[model samples]
Target: MKFISWNVNGFRALQRKMDVFAWLQETGADAFCIQETKLHQDQVQFDTPGYFQYWNDAVRKGYSGTAIVTKNEPLNVTYGMGIEEHDQEGRLITLEYENYFLITVYTPNAKRDLTRLGYRLEWGAAFTKYIKGLDQIKPVIFCGDLNVAHQEIDLTYPKNNNGNSGFTQQERDDFTTLLDNGFVDSYRSLYPEQTGAYSWWSFQFNARQRNIGWRIDYFVTSERLKRKIVDARILRDVIGSDHCPVELELSEYYGRHAGR
Candidate 1:
């Protein structure tokens, strides 16, 4: 099974630039997750015949949101973490398959002045606990814009970005805690030494043109599902968003383990 994740920045804006239907047709992905949709469901006009579409829109207009499009129907679908404090922005969605649960999240960003840092950190802890609980039931595959570059190698100028919003030490440590618990960073596990590979780039300073970016997006799987990961990719060439798509291919072993 192939799962792809991308933070579209704004679904509405992308539609004006490219035909998303045509783009999805070209990839042939089993499931695709998008973050920062920035629009309500009524505002989205997508018509993918065979795919099941699920969306979680923020209460605040033109803000954080997420969605998942899958060819295979899930056994159960859920939105948010069920924690009132974290459910407001419509930042999370979970799809339960027979063998595993696939979740997409758009983590709260710490503002440039670090005004939202405290809230972001609290959200991270709650999110980690939520995923851990799901893991106790079945393996989990979580993806989308996490908004933090875990390591120095994840961004173009780590040294210069030490205390920056997305590259702060506190945020990075929270990411480490998730891995230490049981989840595996699928991309890094597969390409440990690969550098200059990133998912999100700043629109300012001609960043994308210069390949200056940060890999704040990810596909993280429970340790039990690690071996099923066949490949992970950073699709930097694909356009339509400030962030590119990241994909994970799983072996047929997962298919055979269905209905577990």
Candidate 2:
């Protein structure tokens, strides 16, 4: 099975800019998950054939949201982590299959001045706890704009960007704790020393063209599913948002008919 994750920034805006459905067909992904849709349920309509659409929209219109378009129908779909505070943003969605729970999340960003850092940390802890609990039942495959540059190698000019939002030591350490618990960062695990591989770039200063960016998006899975991950890729060439799409291909080990 193959999964694709991208932060479209805004769904309606992308629709007007390019052929969204055509691009989706080009990927040929079994499941296409998107973050930061920035729209309400009634705001946009997508006619996606050969796929099932599930959306989690924020309480506020034109704000943080997520959605998944999957070829296979999930056994169950959940909108959030059941936390009222966290659910308000529509930042999370979980799809339950026979073998695993697939999640897409748009982690909150700490403002430039760090005013939201405290809330960001709180959300991280709650998110960690939520996934760990799900992992206890079955394996988990979660991906999205994690909003943290995990390690020095994850971003360009780490020294100059230190202490900055998304590159802060505290945020990085919190990410470490998540991996330490039981998840594996799929891309980094496969390409340990890969440099100049980033998913997000600043719109200003020609950052994307110069390849000055940070890899804050990821495909993470339960440690047990590591061996099943065939490939993790950053589709840098595909342009729609500040962050490009990331792909993860899995072997046929845990599909709809796996345990049968």
**RMSD in Å for all candidates:** 1.0, 1.1
Q: Write the per-residue lDDT of candidate 2 for residues 76-127, one digit (tens) a residue.
A: 9999999998899999999999889999999999989999999999999999
Give per-residue CA lDDT, model 1, range 1-260, as digits (tens). Answer: 89999999899999998999788878989899999999999987899998999999999999999999999999999999999999999999999988899999999999999999999999999999999999999899999999999999999999999999999999999999999889999999999989999998989998999999999999999998888899999999998899999999998878677545
Supply candidate 2's per-residue lDDT for 116.
96
Off by over 4 Å in 2: 256-260
Could you estimate the TM-score for every candidate? Answer: 0.98, 0.98
For model 2 the local lDDT of residue 117 reads: 96
* Residue 151, model 2: Cα distance from true site in angstroms: 0.6
> Candidate 1 at 232: error in angstroms?
0.4
